[model samples]
Target: MTGIVTLTAAGAIDATYRVGALRRGTFTRAERYTREVSGKGVNVSAALAAGGADTAAVVVLGADDVRFARGGLTAPLLRIVEVPGSTRVNTSIIDAEGATTKVNAPTPPLSPEAWDATLSALRDELGTRPQPWLVISGSLPELAGTGTPVDLAAVRAAAREHGARVAVDTSGGALDALLADPTGIDLLTPNAEELSAAVGRPLRTLGDVVTAAREIVARGVTTVLASLGADGLVVVTADRAVFARAQAPSVANTAGAGDAALAGFLLGLTRGPAATAAGADPLAVAAASAAEWGAHAVAHASTIVAGPPHGIRALVETSPDLDRVLTAEGEA
Candidate 1:
């Protein structure tokens, strides 16, 4: 993969409001508000672009909001496909305490023609220069009046035919559909809750997280990276496992922290090949990057901004010893 290309089918107008406090039973006036076009993949692209990486996004934009999406994102390349429906709006309310209350709108359905067009564009890119890590993220839109065949597998198959590696970050039925094939994905990133939901149980501890993630690996996933809020992350592959944690940074708002982590994880992959003597388990290195990036996102006011505003190296040094952590699996 040359760089990253995200499929942000579920694009949205993201709005964030800042207020002194949010009391459930009263009217709370906003002190400030910021709005932009975002989706999970869009957020990843923004953060990657912030880190000075070349990125691209393929999104379904409302015909009217094309300029807004293009202008707000950090990506230099955008393959825009127009659909008839208005883009959904997602709202996040951040309080002085850094707690966030989010309101996510339903995904807009894609016309059969629009979906087909999107696939065609993706194919063209996969066949062209700058082979990229094709990321299929966000929720699946319901099929609208467009009687597009629900052939999601065909999309992945087409990518593989063109020799592209895929990464996934999605939940609910869409996630289940992906997990069913398991080994088809190059990487899978899930927060604890999403991991639990996928395995049909509640994960309450790190061990629980490991067990659930291991199950996904047994089903053929190449690797599982589960983000556990302040506790850090668990990165597991077919042959090894590592648990990594970093010192907690002060929280700003946790809205896009997971996306930030995924963005960092991919960045780490691009850093260099893992040097085992340097404690470089590929998964472990990726986990370290995830913690550092996640911490930085939580330390910022906006998800699109760069890490912690401090730097990534200091935080990564404080994280767990990846090779030592492998001892848990009796591999050290």
Candidate 2:
């Protein structure tokens, strides 16, 4: 239960410009900021490490842009694979009120050799050590080809070969392809829209989500965690189904909420009795923990202004009232 590996994108930064105030068509003032390492995988890894898990992040970083992405990482193991080309930087602008406008730079594609090397590294890591649970999340770099999902499937195969489980948190074509032939995924975590898109239908209620989850599980997934934002989460397994609700907090930023949920749920799954017991309703427990953790993570993350990225220190410090809501009846 201790070994866990997360595969993701990585890069250094360039510069971000924030423009405030707009009169007619021109900006009144513009502010420039230096770049930093930012991506979905890094954020999820940070959350996992903050939650006291022995987590390692495997990502590709630009040759020169190393400090920005690798800096501030306190994870027990942070492995960076050097790649050519400067990493991408994204820009954002907000008016005096709070309206935001963002422009994102393009991410370079990983070379075929780089991709092969990454998979090889993953295989070697899993092969040598204890069976490490794999969390494959985030979008592939734009340049990485259409075979990204297939490549991920190969990674899943290797993990399974070594007696590990995988949680896939991605969308679009990759997700569709994976669902078409889900062979190694233990958990599928997607939001409502992504779930609807994957199932090729509209999901408007908890019942629709449950139906969709049943269909996906029928295809091949062992479990489904469909996040419904304010409506909370709906979790479905082969033998049990449950929905965990939370009182919504004031949301400042929604960037890493799902990542937080994934980390929290996985934390529960790996550490708690959820995985070992037959017909155990760990999904309800995991979903509750995920919702509570996500709400608090978003609250704390939104408070940080341009300084260092907010770690999970605050979220870890605060405990949500999960016990009051997740009684035996809730799961039943």
Scored by TM-score, the top model is 1
Estimate candidate 2's alpha-carbon lDDT, on a 0 to 1 scale.
Answer: 0.64
Give Cα-based local distance difference scores for all models.
Answer: 0.74, 0.64
Question: lDDT per residue, candidate 1, 1-332, as tens digits?
Answer: 35777887877778899999999899999999888777887778777777666677777778788777667545366777777757888899999977888999988777778888888877776667454677887888866774442457767887678777788898887888777876678789988778988888977666677778889988888889888766677787765667666654577767788887888788777664644556666656767777777778877676565533255442333233433322132121
For candidate 1, what is the TM-score? Answer: 0.87
Candidate 2: where is the Cα deviation over 4 Å?
9-35, 74-76, 90-104, 142-150, 274-281, 302-332
Q: List the residue pairs that clash in candidate 1.
A: 296-308
- Every model: Cα RMSD to truth: 5.1, 6.9
lDDT of 2 by residue, 236-297 (tens): 87766666655535444455567777777777676667444655445555766676667655
State in Å the error of residue 184, model 1.
1.1
* lDDT (C-alpha) at residue 92 in model 1: 91
Clashes (N, CA, C under 3 Å) per candidate: 1, 0
